[model samples]
Target: MEARLETEVCVIGGGPAGAALALRLARLGHAVCVVERHAFPRSHVGESLTPGVWPLLDALGVVDEVRRGGFLPALESLVCWEEPTGRRVRGRAGEPGLLVDRGRFDALLLGAAASAGVRVLQPAVAQRPERTADGWELPVLHEGRRLVVSARFLADASGRTACLGGRKQMVSARTLALYGYWRGDTPHGPETRVEAGPDGWYWGAHLPDGTFNAMAFVDPELLRERGIGRRTLESFYRELLGRSSLLEAWTAPRLVGSVLACDATCYRDTVPIERDRIKVGEASFSIDPLSSSGVQKALQTALSGAVAVHTLLARPEHAEAALRFYTEDQRSSAEQHAAWAAGYYRDARSYQERPFWKRRALAPAAVAPLEVRPPLSEDGLSHRRWRLASDAALVDTPCIVGDVIELRRAVSHPRLGRPVAYLEGVELAPLVDWLGQVPGEGLTMPQLADSWARRMPFRRSVAIMGWLYRQGLLTEVTADGPR
Candidate 1:
């Protein structure tokens, strides 16, 4: 007999993204069921987490658990990209990142989700889903037993598998990552290491379990061109590592596991979110591995995705805002990361002539050249008169308001990347509107700031004013006219 389960939200996959989403939804009083193919404590890649992940974890109420999980703190990094010689880069004190054993890290999150009243079906394979009048119905196989799950909303956090199945829009050159774990005497400090090679780049890091992971990212075409097959894959991976100065620190390293290869190219799902379904983490988009923030980005998507899903379920009137907010957020994040990766690739002087570097170093065409402006000294700020730029205006934008997505009036300018809804938790539309109401003759920086200070903090008003000037949203008033 087949078992049946019903939930407000059905999340596929039990990795960080799925688990985080399930946990958050359950905490929000929504019935969430998660179907995962793998059991707990399964081996996975992308172990490094950036410092930015702390706030998200804290928000998820998993900070204490993560701290006690025995993960290594990534206090420093050794890099040899721009120059041949490696240099040590240290993060801020008491706020280092983490080098995690992904297996345990993922399990910890899944366990948290289960403890939070989320129904978890581990070792379950979710089959194709069927759209229903209300939501979706999916068939799942669990431990030789067939089960059916019906949900009001569907969430795909299945990483690159993308169980929801949509066409992916490639954002970067096709690339492959070949990697393996090794056990050996510590030849280098606990810092993560990165080096740019002639044809590709190398990354190596020490995990908390005393195992070192070394990886090589290169063009997939290179493998076919060199006729690298399963029989010669290990040898070829070693040969590539031998050319690396940074990873060479592993003395007498013994391969603890077989060399594995997977696609690492950046891409985004053409449709990441809809009214009844949503995709988070790598299912929505994947960024370059150069930033070492894949796990961080996944968790970010989960947090935001949870809110989006909640709004879609509980506040039907805000469905459009919720969908638009999540879609725009995903696109913006992917594009920004792509641009950042290209800039970093261009900085690698060692491999500028190589095909891998040359292909990735080119910046995206959508990035506009930033307008350079002279710094405004305090004396100059008080002396010059200013008025709102002609192009600056208030536009309606979808923004996250507390728990639900809402349309808010935001300041818009060509110089700004997107509409600015808020800054440092202060609503910007009101401030921009007040600035517009100023006399055409304009006011000195101090005069305008003093008048605005009556409404808010003096420092906050000045900060917003400075941002306007920096973004060219405010223009100078000259003897002739506005400049």
Candidate 2:
């Protein structure tokens, strides 16, 4: 005697990731349902965001609404990480980002999703997720009732708890965040203030509501005995606040509330995708908040994840490939972000000896020269499997080298930050037209490189061939030796 609901997709956790996905998929004419454990306008942190988020929100048709929400603009950061005595201020006033009231921002998005034909259930807790042949059956608790939602796909947009991880915890740095809100002048006006101290680091930003939000990032062990309680947390927050000149400017500013704590560590989910279920947003992985990319990362993951899910449900034949791409890309993006944040810890010479900093400053993985295996030679025939990925519709971007309109398209990939080209900067796809119509046999990587060697040396062609192979653009085809 249980109530039941059915849909094409049931997304768990109605945060930005879940809501955004539900909105997009529903707009695509799919029956999507989003289940959330918390009610709207719930307390959540992470106000500071990256500028890159504007375009993503625009794509979702929410940018105009978000802009009119009167969120505080964040243009630059005032950093004090130089340790002994160093200060750096960087901001882009014209290209400023916003500091949001997280509760409100999240509520707006969820509401937008609901209005966009996405069925969102509030105060709903998801029980164990069971995978089915067609998709998944998610048992959800709402309004003192157990409801079963049957869907063709299940998405876990749960936050760092990553409900989808389902007891198989991924290895992650267990850094704890202790933060509080205050009514006073923040260290830097409107701009954020970041500094490194004994235990870990501190972040402070002026909220749009004429209040300030300050958070301390440190090892959980550092908070032993003197951490959670109201009095103890206030003392801990004060001790760390006193270390910063920014906080000292305030003379007994009124404390707004109790100090809240949560895990802010960087980690990735190693759980493989199963059945028709996938994880998006923090449910997939999380990184250090030091990068101030928490929200932006969630949006990016959601965007890509939507594409992946759509591909899987719409075109089952490509499910394997699409899902594979989604998982690998999400994991790699997390790894790269972790590596990027580690450098900040390592750069602070003042805390190199501190146990907290020392542990975080572990030597980053050394970058090796980009190389390809099974070598390339001119006499070999190069083969390809996947179509070339590019932003340009055709070889449209014109590049001039020695007086010729050598047009090329921008090759793009999730792992790469910018467009890439091979052999004298020509788009790899257009230059390989002859490979399909070779006279005798197929063209090897080197031959492809040589044909386009008009702007590159022979040795350089070899390198380009290897590069293309590494990018999975050119097939090795070295099995039968030059046939």
Candidate 3:
């Protein structure tokens, strides 16, 4: 006999986003069901988490469990900018984040969802979501048979598969990604490492078990122009990272995990969120990874999605408005970040000198006035500087050596060049106070670093202020106010 199930809410693709949503709805006493194609302990990329994600997991009551999953603390980040002078600048090191095992992480969260009474179907391929008379019908291929499950609301948290968005003709290809995992000599200090060059950008970080999760992102147009094929992804990445020099230290042949591949793109919907349907995570909105906002975005979608689903089940009329607001925020966030990521990629040495960049870089969409908001704390000076440069300054011109050096100094602040040996255990408060003497507004990170260096330049300043923000010392306020 073919299996049949009934649920108030159906979540497709039980990744972090889907699982989180499922757990929320199930905990709220809803008959929620989640469909996933993969079992636990599967190989997934994106092994790092930005700092604030813990709060979301905590809110979902899964924080303690996730913490037990061998999470590694990320201490700081190192970003390399290739400049026009044929030199490179390693700019802006800030506070730590987290390096996690995606396999363990996904399994833990999905398990939490299941524990919360969410009926989970694994190794099941979801074919499509068709609207039924009363609600929605989710068709899936399970055990060589088609199973149709009825749900009051259908959620597509299917990552880049874009289940609902793809079928409905709402997703747009605004950006693309090539991601994989690696396990060579792990990078020290648990930092997210970023290298920028003409061809594209590369990001990698140490995973929990001393492996590495790394990937490259490039413009689809550029990839097409150069005729990039799967077989050549390694050579392409190697050549690109070789220019930055930072990747050289870890590119040895002995890494444990072989390189894998995945694609990411920014997709926005043509129709607003309506009753009976919602898309979350990569399916709802996606941008490039330059901002490292993947997991955070997914969490945000789940949180808001839970509320929307509840409202839909309870009130029904407010469903459209709730979903509309959800999608509007998603679209606004993606567009803002995508414009910045695309512009930052254009500033790379490989693209800046090429005609392709000349056209795209100068296009109206590449550069738009952004509503600027100052960082929440003085500590986020370095991060804010990078944001402004990538979002505002680089949109106008290519990044130069001087620009990058300036960013470094800003990140370092008063601590510029002073070795630990010289400080001899002095409290860091005095040093931070001294650095705060220099105003940060209207200056890039490099300029601030230069200013602090002039005071007494011997130590590397990984601007503690930016680190402060990562440590939650600051709050981000939008134009309207704190969000």
Candidate 4:
């Protein structure tokens, strides 16, 4: 006899996205059941989270638990990319992103979901979802027993598993990442560090427990060429890191029980949100890792999905509209991120030295015109200004501004408090020169602001170009193009 379990919502894949959605649904007084192929405390990759994560956890009322589960605060990211200056221009992680151990973090989220009255079945995998007239029938396998789960709605949060592939099978470019953790004697700072290393790129952060989290992404072609075995992948990773003085110092010999590896980087082909089912997190849209929007994107997907799911479950008549909105949002996020990745890796200045980087780095940020502004002079005595194409009034012969405006854009914050912002580029320079040459260098951001507090006019015909980088603009960048 087939066992039967009934639920209002069935969530597959107990990763961050799955747990989040399940928790939200249960909190709404729905009988939600989450099925996971793996148990809690299992290892996973993409160990970073943008500030946006805070709001999601807060909404679920699990921020304190997540914070205690070895989550490290990330101030900024030090990224080395190719530029005309022949030097790496470091970029911030958009105001204090968090570094987390996926094992503990995922477990914490799943536990919280369970506590919220969501039923969780560990080591339970969904083989397929059979469409039903009233809802959907999911054939789930837990341990050695097979069971049928009936739910009004189904969510595919199974990471790369794509359990509901019958509706849409996402096509992905094959990619590989080899990484591990270590306890070393070296000293480090609070910032999570990343740079183009021998293998591909390395990201490391200091955990609260005095240990270090580090990993290297190896080239797929090189890994194949070397014919590295499962055990040898870890050894090869160690050897590759040994060449980097900065990373090598912190990593002594260590053991990685189950080395984390993934074959999909870009989540180009995935199911769109629809009436009968929805895909969240990596299952919905996975993009290149260079963008570092992994956890942020996942949380955003789940949160936005919660709204749609709630609307549909509460008002079944408007289910189509909710699905449409969710699909559009996912498309915008994926395309914008892909464009950025293209610009970053495609530019030679970022990683021309390493053949592996040449292949991986070429992808640009999926979004065009990514709030990029010209850098400030090191001396602070002089500031440079440029015209942005997006500005309408200044489309032609735009006047130069002395300082950058709104450089400190707080990405996320609670409704009651002020959000944190980080400095991006310099603004308003022409006005400063016209009024009186402000003393350069040794000047702080505040002092620069006080000196040229008022906006002025410029006769020098500085034009802000009227270019719109909606998304996927990075696809235009090539080796032969103008740097």
* Backbone clashes, each candidate: 0, 5, 22, 41
lDDT, candidates in the order shown: 0.90, 0.72, 0.62, 0.62
The 10-residue segment of model 3 with minimum total lDDT is 391-400
Error of 1 at 392 (Å): 1.2
**Candidate 4: residue 155 Cα off by (Å):** 0.7
Model 3 lDDT at residue 225: 76
* Candidate 2 per-residue C-alpha lDDT over 330-406 given as tens digits, one digit per residue, 9 for 90 to 100: 66687677667768888878888898987787635423334344543433324432223232222333332221223
lDDT by residue for model 4 (5-78), tens? 99999999899899999988787777999999887788677777777777777877987887667567777554
| Candidate 1: Cα lDDT at 15 | 95
- Winning candidate number (TM-score): 1
Q: How high is each candidate's TM-score?
A: 0.98, 0.77, 0.67, 0.69
In model 4, the Cα lDDT at residue 325 comes to 59
| Candidate 3 Cα misplacement greater than 4 A, ranges | 82-96, 143-146, 165-176, 183-189, 221-223, 251-258, 339-483
TM-score attained by model 4: 0.69
Q: Residue 210 deviation, candidate 1, in Å?
A: 0.8
- lDDT by residue for model 1 (439-461), tens: 88889988888988777899988
By lDDT, the candidates rank as 1, 2, 4, 3
